[model samples]
Target: MNQYVALDNIRQELTLRTIPAITLWNRLEARPRTDNFDRALKAEVRDALWMLTKQWQMGEFRGDDAGSPVTSKIHMSTTKLSKYVAGNHDVQVFDDTVPLEAKAEQRPIPFTIDTQKVSLDIRLLMGRQWLKMIASTGNFKTAYVTKYAISIPDITDKNDVMVTAHREAWQQVAATAQRCMDGYELYIYLKSDAAHHAYDTIPMTPVQQDAIDILAGKFIIWYEKLYYQPLDPENNAWKPDFLEYQFGCSAPQGSGEKVLTADQYCDGHLDWYSVDIDPLSTTLGDTGVPVAPPKTYTRSFIPVPVTFDGMPDTRWWTFENGRTNFGNINPGTTDLGKLLLMEFGLVFANDWFLLPFTLDAGSIANIKGMSVTNVFGERYWIEAAGKGLDDDWNKWSMFTLNTKGNLGELTDPGLLVLPVTPKILESKPLEEIRFIRDETANMVWAIEHTVPLMTGASKRGSEAADELRKRYQQLLDKDISDGTVVSPVPVYKADIRYQVMNGVPENWIPFIPARMEGSNRSIRLQRAAMPRILNGDAAKPEKIRPRTTLLREGLDIDLCKPYFINEEEVPRAGTNVYQSYQRSRWYNGGVCTWLGIRKQTGRGEGHSGLAFDQTIPVKKAE
Candidate 1:
């Protein structure tokens, strides 16, 4: 039987396995950072990492699927609060696949079939761990304490169930959210120092506080709407209990003025007036009339920025209260300068990385890597040659239509050739070039690491021309037999542009080159390796990951490079990035230990294998 591990269970498992915590603070000390701003910024980065890990473990942070962990909670009128998951009602209490025996004589069953439903008591353990981690980060701690919730449950004058349910749900939500927050805290730590600076916000800024309030409101509302169900209907059952609870309705005093029906009023109190209700009358004595409350509110608060100094020079900053007065000092003195530089650097990198993908015209095939170098010099690897598109016919023209001429007249339809152009410009004349397979004995020419051709034509249009084209079609059909064909490109040292054309070589669609390479083979080698390195897949990964559907079906190499490299087989480290806040190596030390073979090209660039969330079938034992 296949068992799927739950996110919370995964977290607990990770906690048990790793001795030292792999948090942001610890990572900061591990990696070299020179500036004061880097030190302060490390804390925030740690928080982000912590938040990410915790979120992942708690099911609070979703991956590409974009699903929330909390499922829907439905409310119905009953004297007892009964929780029913919206769709989970279809789940069988016991496996129905097991046969109930029809024994003639009363014999003891061979296997135990206990039907007792064991309740899970994971709330306290999960909550305590999460709260402690989040509290380590001052920013997260502030957000949590300020926006914490208290449960409200129903009571039968003397017996309260709603109160208990409310408290339990609140505790559960808080615990899960705290884990997510801790993960985020840790994620920030794993990020580069420069990236941390760019998103740096004023510590505990009111805007941030307001954001926390909004999130708290949203999550709490989700919990109440999805997890909390009302048990009492009549006033005597739990009406008094609901109204008297400390965490009861936050609705205004006249919230139920228009709730004419008893049902509406009863549900309204429990649901905080979210139930249907008409607008109050706005006339002289109506509840909707504007009456100022006893308290007045104002938004005119200006707070100063806080600065912490760890530098030793006079040029450094001296703070009186929250304000800092920077005297003329050198670079190492004031923390402000470093913070400013870090922030600016982060912004620049963000712009560069988030730049939109723009298609370059001219040579689409070249940019997309559909062209390959063969013994015929550099040629666009066309898997199949079909009749060109007749403007009148939106469908593909038949290969036999090559007999048709330019203006509906029959002429020698010269072989409809697929164009392949090199993406380089060299002053030297084209001479002495040999495009052959590397590390193979045969004279077989594989287009961009594709399967070898069965036949190679010595002349362009001899008796072998027909045979070559036939072989090409055979390979084409075989490659594309499964599904859509995507083109492939030859290895290049630098980025070249290409435009795709007719589907060829099984799943491959062809493309025209944008910038043709120069006739220099040496130059091509440099460009080829550069792109491979940039892609986080070094020349040799200990284990080459299986090709994805796109790659397996022959997607254009250039287009697939980014997607493939991103889908590397490198395993993820288990420790939370924000674990440093715990002040224990057990929580943060091994956070990124799984990233053993780091790609040497750039910082923050590394191989990412298939994520844990992807579902792949496991082979069953006989």
Candidate 2:
């Protein structure tokens, strides 16, 4: 068996360096260097350099202190005094998210799971030096008192000062408690603890439970005084503990009146009576039988000159000898004035009996059988007597004869019989022109007279009337696009007249001079050809011929003289000749066509016309 050494002994020998264990030590240290070692070392050096560079660039390590010092004083709790009073601490039993209900019910309440309950009070303390200063100053006293004298003891030591400070701070906290509790209230059942565990089990009626269930899951606040009741002393009746406690449910009342049912409320209170009842029964007695209404007749008679049978006659009539002069008649004293004078004469003559007529059964027969000649004779009779003739001359004569007698009644004793000349010309051109002008004027006057009536019939400033006025103005302005007017003149005459009479400026007319005829024709031709040229169909090869024969005659070959040409390799002949050469034996036989090169031998021939080398032996005529 080989001698064995213990591990502890070997470790001692190695530690003591007494054993020659260099090979073992070298074997233990001889690990092959892997790529990861270099990579790890490089990564460590990069990280260190990056950290150092970042620290230098940021200047974060240039501050005076490495860590901040604590400046606040530590508070020590004492078991002798209540922490609530000494620390001025208040415990909040309820927060805003807490659900408070008027009654208890089994319903899910979605209260916030992360509700935070914070203390209402915060600890406040003065420094020990400040407390000592207060002790030195002693308690403040009033200069004078009206009601009573007061005594204040001076502070002696730190304990007395501490006691006074604590007392004053507690007093201040107690004073602020009422203000803090102004809108706050806590409800408690008889058996409920400070955590309100018994509130969930309170007794509630079905209506109260239903109310709680209806308002469930809603974050709500309830005050204690609103629902709390106290026993009455006199009648032992329960009453509200606080009569003025306000419940904040401010919803509106129902729409219907309290005193009325739905139908009565809908019908309303006003009395209604039927309007179909007759009012005449009570107002008037049996004498109120409807009387036939009096007949209403329209006057229909106008004060204008009346023609035969009251018809408006436009026919112009002349007496046999009405006038002798040929000058233009005054328009004011023309036919209408004469007709008016004739009417006045007829009435006057009938009243004064200047002429007479006879009436009998034969006269009535003659009146009924009257002809145009008899009517004209009657008009002549009145004109000869220098009297006016009524439009109904026949009837007037018959009436005069029937009522007042005889053929001759003193025969115009007072009237003057002036010799009157008749108008010979009936249709003068100038008279017709004046008549047309008068008629047009009358029409225009009639239209203008109706404007006020039309405006009254329509609403004031209506669109219809405005459009009518606009169209009327356009008519007056003669707004025609085709160079025509209301009178429709010839186009050429109209153009000339419009240019001259309308004062049209020369610049306003788009004129092109006749001198540009050739250019304009060329432009038009080019315009007509543009589409064909753009479509690549300007002229077909078969239809078009070149203006110059240079290209066709191969004379345009001179145009290529500016380009460089190679002397060693000359170009071939024309395309047709080149193509023929390619098909012939010369090109196929590889003949050189270059300008300065010698021709080669044919395909079957050698360079010096020998079929093979002359030095080699050959059979002569074998």
Candidate 3:
């Protein structure tokens, strides 16, 4: 009930005063300003000679016939993206410089199915780490250990019986990489180099080919920076939900009958291209207006002066930067963008400008306007400032790219893209997952929140589902202490009282929504599953499924298929996604690596009390 104010300079409680002054105004004394005449803070200007007679009666020192822009040019065009195509494969071509978000969410190596299929314990753990690093460099044995039925044993034996006699050479490189895998799609999809299913077959030698080139170069530094690529399992093509792209530009020399398109691009960069999408420009007819030519360019710069982050200082009695307070801007009489951003920071911060220019990581440009030139050899040809009516949201623009034009057409001009990328590093995630939304259990759970394991390391998804339910309760207590184990019996009939569907933990999984196939109202989400009653074959239960590979996409085409997901990409604030392992170097310094996938937006909706019909009644013993 007693707080006072003003006692700064580190006296902790600096300002509290909610009416606690209590009359303490101390400035008492026998005064001492016996007239020194320098009372400080007044600084001249009391109409300094009527401000120099109104700057010579208003001609304000005359000096404005315009003359600043020295040298500029611009006139761009560019194009390049060459071809890549996703979904139904077959179009590839961008030759080679890598990035389209690391070949579309990474993964050209590291195979362990998230439906990229390879798994048979990743082909016998890459053929038992290529026969334990070429049997610790001694007898590079490859006689298919007595031709296929496999049995080499003595690499000092007991490494799990030389890994169960090379389990038929890792089940023939995971069945020849599930019969030569392939897949492709834009914002997600990748599965191609299953390390050529271990030397395209035939028990190889050269020290099991240089110990699988040092274990496929450490699964190219940790499974492409840690797993992603999973989408096009028949997700069809041509903008399979647009990681966006549209290429094909023309119009120079008799306009090739007008049409030069190219910037319908999507927002996934780090050296752009939408990883693949070009099958003869797949559809959007009238051939999406383009005839092919565009390349021009033309540089020439020099116009500089425009700065940002809290600027305001073109003098008018300057000395005011108490943190950019153009007078605490209280704009609201129908704020016209805060009255044109405070009239361009108090009068067009010196008519702002910059120029910039460069363009070449994967090209796209299209400027078509500049010329400038000033110091009065006089030139003035400017034109590309948010031009107009592409549906004019008061003509605004920033990184450009939207293209297809259409809304009452004719505005067209905006192109940009660059695609540069190259700055890399990443790491931390190794599988996160989130994906909430529950509406009190109406579906969407995902939730693993870091799982990874199979010993490549990672934990806490409730400690890996309580160490997978204590190794399935020590394999149901070593099958009940091995007494001719026969615990499978449930045939009840007396009013059918035996319970069946009710278990959950393998990290919460579920998803649900449904409807999309011929849309009776277009719905999406899908994924679903949550039964895991630890299959002792109670007529095949086991559903839990997800240990993170971004929610195991489609469990290899069939554990009942259905994956889906698009219901406007999970709303009510939730979706996250994680994986990680980037690296980067290129342009000859080499070192690239991959495994990307990011996704964001979550911190909302959750409720895994995922239920189902059940019973809890047992009174006989009491």
Candidate 4:
């Protein structure tokens, strides 16, 4: 709507005396601050009347009924989580030496399973040490020690005596220490009966026990280090995973202790919020345990305002370069987290304070009440942020555990849990298995991307599956070529007219939806396998089992049983579970080592293209 009174307006405006022409444009300027403090555009009076006026308009001058809290008498109670039980094991002490995360997730090194020696690592490492020990003790003849000797390549230019010893010998004395080893002890560990798990020579002698201890005990101790270790074991310290194993730390002290045995720990990571008190009740899916007793203590401390890296500063006459800019926040209605955080920083940041208090890692802590002494010598008792009827949905607070029980059970108010977990280490996944739901098939597939081999190395699932099938094929070939069979006929020809079922990847172990417990309505993913018909023989069907340990829970038993995963664990989006070697140091500089499982969210559902009752026509030869 441009008004044009052209010629007349120009003549009328020519009579102006003092006023200059006014113009308007979008404001833009080059901002270059070589020196952080630039006073060119800064109004020096910003800290004067302008600040006061702004604060006044925002009601900052409104006097509070009482002065701000200077110190807080925190009456807090804590119970040492004195019990820890791994899986269904007996309850034992919850040692506070190592972080609970390490304890809960640590994998124990089982020496053997009945007749079989379980690990090649145990044999290799322990056998090498045994030969060294023997040589050092002069217990065995030099010839005998040399017979089972193990040698590592000396990485030193020690032309002096087989090059410069084990180089950088000053770093670790053990590295340069001369040992009676020639790598032959690895063979000894494999062949010798003394190294076997069930080597029971009738009338066992002291020498035999000593040999066993050196071979097995030392190997076991290599991974299992005590927090307050004695001189001998500490001296024998070796590299290990982020797992520290102790003898008597498995105990269930109170009601909520059962949560540890549930599926949450199945993946090794412990998320306190998802845990339910009644883990034994399958209906709840995720369970937690309500521990007995509440501890109380009183300590006064000068409260400090809670601060975060990007949080807004209180002063208005300045700009925080990288700090949160509330003005720049373009939050949508669904961005509740961002919106709430921004709102809190802008309006309620001053109301929050932090206190530093230490608690044992496994135990939960609750601040019963707090008496705050203000700057005016006025004391005010403060209640918890969520101090109201426990059943009220509106009452909310952070870090509080949920009260769990059946209906009509009088529930105690949930306590603020401070589980002593730490930011521990996670190595590259040794075994990766993804549990993906196939909605069309009404089944779940445990796709093993990575699998552990017998040689203590990880292999791609596809390659490992191929190797496994090759092994089975070799066995079949050996059987077919046997001379005892008189003109052994192949059960079925490889060039068949029809195929019964479509083949899926051997690594994709199927989990059929089965009735949970006895309820047909409630289904769980029960581990199932496709039958492998070797040499096209339907009668000679074999189980195509999973190679990944996460999917082979109950299959290795004498009587193979179905392993079931909770349906909720594998949701529509799916679940990714991985086992890896973890290594970290605890609070006391004690090395933590373990092989633990970690679970993450999968991308989405997957299609295995698994089909049954298929028909295939014979292909014409070219």
Candidate 5:
């Protein structure tokens, strides 16, 4: 009976399972399985990851956070995901977000890079595309763009605006791509050019090179601030000496609004210290109110102008005791004035008196036989006689007086004056001969005293008379015999003479002539008569005025002699003799105050034969 019950239960269970099994079989027939499911899942995951990576790299994430973690709940469309999973290689991560079809036909436009404008067949990519910028130095950078289009504001119409905008947009894209490239060269991957999948490089234009150079200059300032020492007291070094740092658009002045594009600001302009930050309130602490530190600051340096004392004039005289107060006479007050004083001491502004002398006929005749006694008491015979007068007789009238003295007489007091003579007592015109002029005057009188007992009426048989007659005959042949009449016509003019004494006192500086103008004979006399100052034991003998021919129609004087001052030796005396000669030569003769300390002339040459301690009996002049 139990066995019969078990069989009935099994049959009932089998009958219920058969109906469900048939339903399952029908459902299985409706839907079949495929082998590519795992591959599809894997592809979907890969596509998702790629999209996430691209979004993160392009700064498209929330708050543009690249470090954000990737989660499974990222927003994605099923259709796009399916396309990637289906192995559609054309599927881009931004395919859905950006438009992929042309909204309108794009018209080509010319774009400027720096100063160059070029028309390119540039077209836009409707969808965002990836770009890789490879620097020449092997650095890599990436950027993304939705389209190649530029925006130009304030256009006349939408069409024109669109064209300009497209050009500008292209420039913006290209500039951004090239910003981090070495030398700022541009490299880009375009959607239109399918043959070049990799980034193609564009050479830098001149404008681009200039822009980079400016950028480099600015960057170096920052780099120096970080790595270099602005002031190192230990090494005695400092930053480059500059007045100030400037920051502004480097566009040329008046380039117009159109030329002042974005590229103009790449290089900064020069800044002057005049427009610097306020000196009274420079630092933030000094502002008294809280403020952020300036983004840029400048360092500047200014030097002070030099100041000095002036020089004395060439005609400025100082007594032997007056040298201690030389600082009293201010010299070289102005730039040009100082240069003149230093180069040519006190140039004569107007012609002035050179010596104290009268040019009248009686005075000229009186000085004929007189001797000029120098400070040394040495007598010099007066040789040729002439006079100078300007339009104003009272202001200027003097004689050209030549003297014949010993060779070594040009020391201490370098000048000679006719202090006392028999002719002076006879004429009784002035106390002393003084004041010489520039204009030449007639030779009034020369040595006309008859030779003692040697005139035409004297017996010619005596030996002394014969000798005197021979001399007189020789003088007559030369047309200059005493008593021979001559017209009162002007002969020769006089020029100033600069005589360098043999020995100069330690505290004394002689008056070196600046400009001397006259005949060659006058120039020679002026130069040859200069005393050569000696060093150690090498004493150079003073010059002596040679005996010249008597003046018949003109003054007879020597013309040849070495007159130039040696350049190497000129500086030792703190003067430029040759330059002085050149400048002073144009002026007529005049008396200039000899700026020197006068002293008694030494008489060593006259006493050379006497013993050092011996005294010689000398007869006094009556």
Candidate 6:
């Protein structure tokens, strides 16, 4: 009688019947949601539980399948339990065949030990399996795929290149995965072959090693969550199994899908909170509507974006200011403006003016010195010298449109801006001078300029004694010719950039600018514009221009050095100097304003700086 029901048969009965698990569990005084102990433990429990239930439902152990109840030929050869038992009862038939003294002895088959505890354990395993199956069927849309290719040859440091790419992808996955599960550990193995059959033979650099360390930290958290539950030592079941030997319970099997009571549900949640709940919360109360834990835990290790204001991100975006003693300019806050580089040298006396003052009195030929090419490809020359026309530059002809407003124009003030790389000529011979038609004025001008003359030939001052200053300037000039300039013409590479605007499709973000917002700056783009080199005749030494702040705050001119003074009037011990060059409250004081410099002479290094109330030639950031 005790051997009648095998554990398998009892499991089948529990699955086939409609026994509520919670009800059965309550009746047996067992933890119904025990498998829901921790998110880490859920999947394993679910898997084992489901397998047990399915096996029971399929009647895997029935009759002989349950193992032979008795060893007698009558039972072993019989087809049914009733038939086998009936065969043993045939005493008269058996005695006639085996003799009067031979009698059949009967031994009862014990029932299999399948208890309520075992049934509950199976339910927990079922939950774990369900979770795993769901996880394996993860939804991956094309939109979420982060596959990208790198041009290996384009990168110089192979190690750095690979490390950077790996870091980038790791960050993306970590961030996205958090939204789903507490966190998931990913296995990443690098391969040199497409089949991933062979791994890279190259040694990883220190940087790569560091990147791997970072990734490992993030990866471990996920692995621990995936396999944290303690296995059943007695049953050898990875999930849950009630060990009858441990508790010594022997009730009939009973399990079902029943909703847990409020108290039970709360208890389950409490256990989850007790553990580090990877992505889920550890607390519960009426603080507000109970927000369920996030579906997953995202690795909170997103690398900060390359920025100009923050460390590592800030280094490349900012530059040094040219006017304020070469002060550091915070690109994070500086407004868009022109970066000017001036070049200055001497002009021979005869080469000072472009057109001859008295162009052969009545020459029919147009003056060749003042020709400028317009955007329409037509060349315009000024030949009105001494022919009922003013010699002044303002009185000369002016073309207002370079390319209309299309070529980086500003509607606020009509000024043309042209970018040109700087050059330094220390004492060179005559060469062809390259010139470009100014888009704003259509007038040809030199590329750049610098201040002329030595301030103190006798006693060297701190400012003038900067040897590296001159060397750095030389290096800057050398760099221009070495890479910036393309021979046969003056040209330079434009590496200007912009920021991506918000509200725009991510694919097109680089080309668009969103409505003004503090956060979303524009994207960057490259365009060819500035010229890098210049060609011209060798220049001669020239006198320094009078020093004056372009926009004076309140400096007294009378107290300042005169622009033109007789040498005899100067004291023997000293010479007159501009107030701006001196250390005074009024000199280089107050707010700095934008100014404009105009070419006063064609050949001479002459420019008259003028202050403007408004910005001109406001070119959009390229």
- The TM-score between candidate 3 and the true structure equals 0.31
For model 2, which pairs clash? Answer: 321-420, 321-421, 322-421, 322-422, 323-421
lDDT of each: 0.24, 0.20, 0.53, 0.56, 0.23, 0.22
Work out how many backbone clashes candidate 2 has.
Answer: 5
By lDDT, rank the candidates, best first: 4, 3, 1, 5, 6, 2
Model 3 root mean square deviation, Cα atoms: 27.1
State which candidate has the highest lDDT: 4
Strongest candidate by TM-score: 4
lDDT of 2 by residue, 1-622 (tens): 7566456576668667775642353344556666467665553443667777777776745754322221211111111100000011121111111111111000111111112111112111111112222232332111111111111222322222211223332344345432322111111221134334211443555654444333321211222212221111111111111101111100011221001001111111111110011111222112222222212222211112232322222222213322332222343655776555455443332232111222211001011111111212321111223223323244322112111123332211111111111111111110000000112111100001011111012111132233333333343344343334333333332212222111111101111112224554321100000010111112331211111111112222445221111111111110100000000112123111110001111122111111222233233433
Question: How much is 33 displaced in model 1, in angstroms?
Answer: 90
Displacement of the residue 442 alpha carbon in candidate 5, Å: 74
List model 1 lDDT by residue over 491-556, tens digit each: 444344242221122211111112224643321111011011111222331211211111222222
| Candidates in order: C-alpha RMSD to true structure | 39.8, 68.4, 27.1, 11.7, 52.3, 49.5
Comparing 3 and 5 on TM-score, the stronger one: 3
Tens digits of per-residue lDDT for model 4, 1-622: 7564445465446565223352335897877757566676564674578778998897767766537778888777665554554443444445567666655655544323322222334434554554565454335434433444323333321212111121222223234234433232333343466445412332345776566456545544553462222222222111111112222221232343323223243444455654445423322122244435546678889988898766666665566657556778899989888888888877776678888897655655656677888789998888777665445677676655444543533223344343444566677777898878898778988889987543344667776666556555544555556642233444444455555577777888998878767686987667788876566342557677666656666555678666777677777898887778777677687777666667778889889887677655555556
The digit string of per-residue lDDT tens for model 3 on 1-622 reads 8555455443333244434443455687766667565654556576678877777676656667458888888877766554444443443444246555555445433344442222334334434444454455455335322222222223222222212223343344434332322211100111254434333344566766666566545544443333333234332122313223334322222232222333333333532222222223333233232335667778888898786645776544556556667768899999878888788777677787798876656555667777887887888887867766556667875554443435454354535353345477787877787878888778887788786543234556776676665555455546656743455755443543545455656777887887877779987777877765654433355566776666665564546555667766668998776666776665655465666556667888877665556664533422
Clashes of each: 104, 5, 7, 35, 31, 48
Runs in model 2 deviating more than 4 A are 1-42, 46-51, 69-73, 76-622
Q: Per-prediction TM-score, please?
A: 0.12, 0.10, 0.31, 0.66, 0.11, 0.11
Q: Stretches of candidate 4 above 4 Å error?
A: 1-60, 64-66, 70-74, 109-122, 139-220, 226-296, 300-335, 353-363, 373-379, 406-421, 439-442, 474-496, 516-520, 536-539, 609-615, 619-622
Q: Give the candidate order by descending TM-score.
A: 4, 3, 1, 5, 6, 2
